[model samples]
Target chain A: MMLWSVVLIPAIAGIAAMLPPMRAVRRSLLVATAVAHCGLVGWVCFATPVVSRDSWFAIDAPARIILAITSVLFLAAALYCVGYLRREEGRTTCDAEEGFLFHNEPEGIFVGCLLLFLASMSFVCICQHFGLLWVAVEATTLASAPLISFHRHHRSLEATWKYLLICSVGIAMALLGIFFLASAGRGHAPGLTLSGLVSSAAAMDPVWLKAAFILLLVGYGTKMGLAPMHTWLPDAHSEAPSVVSALLSGALLNCAFLGLLRGHTVLAAAGLGSFSGELLVLLGVFSMVLAAVFMIRQTDYKRMLAYSSIEHMGILAVGAGLGGVAATGAMLHAMNHSAVKGMLFLAAGNLLAVYRSKNTCDVQGVLEKLPVTGCLWFAGFLAITGSPPFGLFVSELTILKGALDGSHWVVAALYLAALGTAFVAMARIFLPMAYRLPDGSPHDGASSPGAREPVWSVLPPLALALAALVLGVYVPAPLWDAMRQAASALGVL
Target chain B: MEVVSDILVVLLLLSNLYLLAASRITACIQTVALQAVVLGVIALTSAAGGLTLVVVSVTLATMAVKGLVLPWLLRRAIRGADVAREVEPFVGFTTSVLVGAGLLVISVVVAEPLCSSAPADVSAMMIPTSLFTILTGLFIVVTRRKALNQALGYLVLENGVYVFGSSLAIEEPFLVELGILLDVFVAVFVMGIIIFQINREFDHIDTDKLSVLKD
Candidate 1:
């Protein structure tokens, strides 16, 4: 019942959003639903007896955590969307508008798909059936297509095309990988459930297990935006509307990472964990290095954030691969990264709205121009760069400590080096552009220029950033229990 | 016995070379279709048990979808768009083919050692052929200029993926195949709308010229 609430509330509001009603009312409805969903996710994860109905569907602690995070972020974003649309409609009157991105919001295809994407993610997290997991993951691909092309422009179209092609190919490879996984079940219980496979691991064929893990890693890693396989992250994230970016960065990566983790779990049961971990660590380092290289020269702020997302995802993968306390850090970082990054993106949206441009060179001194927003932006910058007093700061520090504790000195050093480089590069942009005022810039959308801190826009990020601070010092018991359960479920100690 | 199937497998690899080397969009489409037919034949011959009617039908369906219908649709789109040759290959055709050949050799060499424990009844050359097809699809994607042609490249790439999926001996491949088809249809449908939009906005469907949207 509670799991249904978590999935159902948004589903209902998403439908309501499609109806011709008061936009504010629609937004309020979404917010109400989201808050309700968060409460229910709390129950399902910590209080409820792990929502499992047969092998087809379930929402365990990890899935519950992800669902709760996405719900909260979605609610915050929905609130921001209400304001963004008013401003957008204001601009829509000026620019020669093509058409609405969707037909009547009541039709609910777009928002319904968003809800469906959420439900499918929950399904992916808990569905014990391997085949269902594949379908659920593929469902996310379909659900997100329209979201990626939300702006419905030419570039959005191109990005959608690239995303579909690359991921479709990747998913198809995953299907092949699934075939290997299935075939590995031959001469055993003949089912692909985790427990079933684990019990029979000693009897399973080594040849097929190795093959399956590789294909699974490549296939799902593509979805997770692992380096050398991360081409789609930038275009998809940047081209989508900012709220969608919040979801993609905050929620989608974890779901895909879970897919890889599932495969790694099977391999670990087969006593071949080291092989996959090595591959994962290599890709993780490569992704971090790639992101750091690209971040320094990137002019588009949205793309820069996209690269940062890749870097964080890389860090998570490396932590998981490093094992022990590092893996624990990865799990904590997942939650913290989602929260801080969600705030940063929403704030970026507010900044972009005022600046009327995405070019970092074009937009500067956010702090002076819009003091409240500027402060939040700077704070988000600090939080994301892993400075103290933020949750991400604690998570990354623990990851480094874990690396050293595990006697992986070289890896620890490399991780530190990458972290420092990313921080410097991000600061190079946020420090001056956010802190220092360039000549002849609008301070606020008022007597000086077309800029002012819209109340609708300002409040969500302020609230979220504050929440990030609160969580950094003290995560609620339910969330901590949820994280622990989720971590344990992933076969982590 | 292995000799004949081995020859067909080698042809599949060569078809990838043809796809990468070919400058003409029509030829790329045809080579991909040809490769699909070859893969279908491989699947048919490689079946351990006597060809079940189910296997027969699957092979025929693979031939129909990947070989005949898809290529035909792509050809119509190509003629409709009036795209003849992809002039600005992202990498030169010769170089792309050479690199593809190198990749093929590497695939066989790398995958050969990995799957050594498997029985010879499963085709040894299957993985290499499929890998080359994957690369070939990627080449067509990067090298092509027109939206329709790029889409064709994408279609071939998908067919390549389908070939790989088929080779993996997926038990419920029919379901997976249907999933693949659904994905392909949605992808192409969306691409068609995009092309139409491109035609409306730019008066042509050349993706290279549709470069106004970049940062």
Candidate 2:
């Protein structure tokens, strides 16, 4: 009943939101559904594992962690959306890309898609069947594509088109991978459930197994924003509304990561752990290096955050690749990254609303303009870059310790170098945006005179930042157990 | 039955080759529809237990969506966008056809080892045919400049995956199969709407000009 409610409530609410013309009702429905979903996930996490009778669905360890992260992130994003919609109501902005005026998509459709996005992501977390997982992942792409182009401009549309094409094709590859997996286990007839695959994995053909893993990695990696396949991410992230960007970074990427982890579990059970691990670590390192290279001298702050997401996803790949304590670290990092990045993107949204520009050079003196957002934005930068007294720092340290424990000196070195570079690059942009004095030169209207930080925007991220700070100083016992269980489940322990 | 499956596999291969050289967007959409219809029949002929209710329903669903509905959507999209042909492809037609042949060879090489261990009831050429179609679909997506054409390529790619999936004797739930079909239908439907918007906004559906948001 609990598992069914968690998925069904959001879907039902999504449909409900589409029907009602009342803005207040829709907004409240969004928040109310998010709260219920988050509460259910919290309860499920603390309780015993829940598996369906036929083993088609289960809230296993990894599912618990991902569900918790996605739900919490969704709640925060939902709260932020209420305020965002309130501010955006009846406003038409001329898109700079084509200098054309357009109204945003209807509020009802936007809210509907948001709830559906939540439902699809929750579905991704709970699905034990590989085929259903593919459906859920693909559904996420379809749900969010409209949200990406909320502004209905050339740039956003272009971003939407690329996102749709790339992810659809990439996920199509994953479908093929699933078929290969089915073929690999043809004689065993273990079915497509994760449990079945893992238990009978040893008898499966190794060649097809390897092919399945590669296809799953490349396919989901495209959605997870890993390097070489991460080309569509920055555009979509920067172009979408900030609330949507927050959800995409903090929630959606983790869902895709969850998909990859499922495949990794099967491969590890098949005794091919090291093969997949090496590939993950290599991809992780490459994403970090590429993000660091792009982050330096970056112009757009939103795009910079997008690259940061790619880098952190790399960190996650590295942590999972190292296994043992590192896999635990990766799980922890997934939580920390989601919280901190969600807060950061929300803060960036606040900045965009007040300053009306995404280019770093265009907006300055955030401290003088919006003091609350500036401070949170600055703290978010530090937290994201793995600075001390933050959740990310703790997770990064855990991953580094895991690398050292595994005697992977070269990986450790590259990981440190990438972190340092990203920190410096982000500092160069974030410091000035937060603290630098605005040049006294007059230019075309950029900063709105009446723009001020709203309680809605400030409160949600404030709660997230507090959560990150709390995690850094002390890891909760339940979460720690959950992370370890997730790691062990992946065969890393 | 084996001969029919073999001929269907050959037809799948022929459709892939035709897509590589086809310049007209409408013609490309038609070719994909033909391939999808062929794959639906292949699903029927290649089933291990002859033909059951489950097999027939799945085949009909595949045919209705892939053969009829999706191509219709693409046709409407091209009509709305006024995009008649895939002119000035990133890779020329001659070169892409040559590449398609190479991809076919690669698919055979890749699938040869797996074919030996595949179930006896399944067509011997099933794996290679699916792989080749998949490669060609990807090829078309990459080399084409038109947004509508890229969408067509995606549909073709999905059709290839369907062929491969149906060839496997796994008993996936009926709901899951329907869910997959619904997803593809929605994907193409969404793509068509976006193509219409793109045409209205940009005056052309050329994806190359969507270079505004990079690095």
Q: Best DockQ goes to which candidate?
A: 2
Q: Model-by-model lDDT, in order?
A: 0.71, 0.89
Interface RMSD of each: 3.2, 0.9
Q: What are the models' TM-scores?
A: 0.83, 0.97
Residue range B118-202, candidate 2, lDDT tens digits: 6677778888989898988898889888898899899989988888877665556777888899999999999998998888888
Which predicted model would earn the best TM-score?
A: 2
Minimal lDDT window, size 10, model 2 chain B: B79-88
lDDT of 1 by residue, A289-347 (tens): 88988898788888889999999999989987876667767878888888888888888
Error of 2 at B55 (Å): 2.0
Candidate 2 docking band: high
What local lDDT does model 1 show for residue A74?
Answer: 68
Model 2, A1-493: lDDT tens digits are 7887888999999988888565669999999999999999888778878655349888999989999999999999999999999988886976543557887888898999999999999999999999999999999999999999899888899999999999999999999899889888877746788988888888888888999999999999999999999999999999999999999999999999999999999899999999889899999999999999999979999999999999999999999988999999999999999999999999999988877789898778776678789789989988999998999999999999999999999999999999999999999999989877667634433553435778999999999999999999999897798899999999857
Candidates in order: C-alpha RMSD to true structure: 4.8, 2.3
**TM-score, chain A, per candidate?**
0.90, 0.96
Per lDDT, the best of the predicted structures is 2
DockQ of 2: 0.84
* DockQ values per model: 0.26, 0.84
